[model samples]
Target: MSAKPFSQGVKSPIVHTPSSSSTTGPEQDERSTPTADLKSAHRKVDRRLVLWYSFVYLIMRIHVSNISNTAIINLEEGDGIKAQLGGLTSQQWAWVLSIFYYPYMLLEPFATLALKRFTPRLWMARIMVTWGIVSMCQGATVNYAGIMACRFFLGAAEAGFYPGVLYHFSFWFPTQRLSFRIVDPETAAFLSGPEREAIIADLPSRAPSMDSKTFDLDQIKAMFRNPTFVPFLVIWITHGIGGFGITFVLPTVIYELGISDTAISQLMTMPAYAAVFLILLTLGYFTHTKRLSPWVAGIGLEVAQIIFYILLITVDNATAKYIFVVIATAATQSFFPIIWPERIRATSGTTSAGLAIGITNGVTQLMGIVGPQVYQPKFGPSYRVSYSTSVGLLTATVATIGLTWLLVRRQDKRTEAAAIVESEGVGLPGEKDRTKQQGC
Candidate 1:
């Protein structure tokens, strides 16, 4: 391939492989991997993105999950928030947990627009600083209402972090590497000019029509008309319910295991998150290697969690229950990385991708509100209501993902059929050429 010098901006490095029917020639095969330079550059990109952003992401999670951890904090002294804040009730604490999800869920989609306006560096720094202030104010709360207000503002302050980061990843990496990141070629000071140009040139141009900053409602409507849209949206909700739902209340769920040592119970929660990290690493590696279909892997993970939840509901032993929760949390959280890249790239245009990503990610936070409510005091001890509900939702997620895959597969067929017809009369039968940017 040869290209004249020009700036077309960057697109995803991953190729969106067409259906088998679209290509008969071996040269047009989907296995046209990146050059050694591109791969090496990607490794460097991966190191910086993973290490730097992981710390940034970790700090945000530490702040969010701190509220849950507080229930068990200073347990030996019996001086936790429950004791400090006029003997806050379990129900009120639940509300504190619940309130954060409201703004966090609602504002997620629009956050992408903010990402567009301010650019990632400025936007992220702005988010982190504001949320830090709000979080610090939370430590000074005197009463239930004071804490509630702090939590609300905290949520509002933290609204865009996850969505903003995901949008950043979508912008920088390919659909394939997305399972792995955000960096812009044009603006990256770390790379020399030739390397920057090489990185941009290596990106497979899926669609270059819409500007990164453009907001096109019609494209979003076109996204809605796509068969895969509703299913993917459903996926965001159900997965949140079944998977992240447990994640939200995991600290409490561990506390409920009749453990006498409150500190031990608090420490137990760490393992589940650790399990999530490990599982994601394992799942991400195999998916990146193209050995597993993300939808299939997601379904399998959901199925495993369903079994774990059932075991959780049935087990009377606290140790047994804790083990199940850790594994279940791992299974639940592991699949999102697998599906996120594919989900975003499936859209037709840039505008639709941003909006859909925002809306769907926001919807996933719905479980944060609903999860706390489901694990209310009334459902405790056995918590059959919560566990059973998770099983049903995981079941729904499996079905929804299957439906989405079929819908997208059918669309691929239609695209291939049209391409087959187009090729029959023109250049090469079964050849379906993708759109490439100018000067390439």
Candidate 2:
């Protein structure tokens, strides 16, 4: 929210925001943040929140991606889930998988707004726990209606987690390091007194909307006008539908490949995820150390997906098929994370950041709604049809990334020009006009 460009984060100031109810809070004065003592702050964030949130998000992902794996949990013995649930038809099975996104898409935005009402740690833990319970209920379900109900509730429970984390990050770190922090005076019970002060001291360098209201229609409305909004939405649409489609059916695809009995089919699915994790780790490093823009990161990853999806569609060899699956999953999941950093960079304040991210995430949830149907049983053996769809979507995602980058770059230049005008406008009108003339 500062005039200083923070899309890269390397030279960005260390700004913090506090809760509205907190006695100690962010400074409201604008000045260059002292970069000297920020080491402790960065270390603290990494130690306390980074690894912890990683684990938390990992659990959420495993749960989200588990349905496809769960479908084959007790397979080969005729005791699979579809068999338990009244021998669900292909359409019925698709609906059961798709139902999870209905509430997830609808409630995600409002659920993100509730972070201020319930506080981050409390609200997020509730979501994590509730989804776990809902998932547990799925294991106990004995009928089609019961499974459908559980899936729907599961979607409702997980609705806010992603966007809420994005909102939380806006308060603590700039775009890149934001993958790893959270704090406020009211909630800095984990920090020493000085450490707490360091994060919450009142300075204009403080984040712009630390004390913003729980809901702001204006901010929500502004999101539509943000240069990056529609582009972000389009990328999410492709990632969610295509990326999720691949992930949701991967286990079944492996199974259909004659990977043999028992759990080998399920176990083999693990490698693709491992590859995804490694790709994400590497991408984070590039974003952090190299100051890589999300557009560059996203485009590179989407291109990888497009390439692999093409290979997957055209290739016929069994071993190569498995290899391409891993590549496709890794490309898509890694690319999916780039949107968040770009989303945060595009929006200025907490409200805009939260709502915009929520909206984008909501659109991505369309993946869960529409993804499973892409891999219906009719297209089994070698689901080239689905692979073609992914290739097409990934191609679209690449174009959207370029469009978003161009738009965001244009906005950035405009902002920089205005910031220059304001900074030089400090003197006589003639001098200001001369500065503007020079800029022009």
Best by lDDT: 1
lDDT of 2: 0.65
Count of backbone clashes for each model?
A: 0, 8
Residue 412 of model 2 has an lDDT of 48
In model 2, how large is the Cα lDDT of residue 114?
72
Can you give the lDDT of residue 173 in candidate 2?
59
Tens digit of per-residue lDDT, candidate 1, span 73-149: 77678887778888987788778889988998888778755766666667777888999899889878899999999
Candidate 2 has its poorest 10 consecutive residues by lDDT at 1-10
- RMSD to native for every prediction? 5.6, 6.9
TM-score of candidate 2 against the unseen true structure: 0.85
lDDT of 2 by residue, 276-321 (tens): 6687766666665545655677778888888887887788888898
Error of 1 at 169 (Å): 1.8
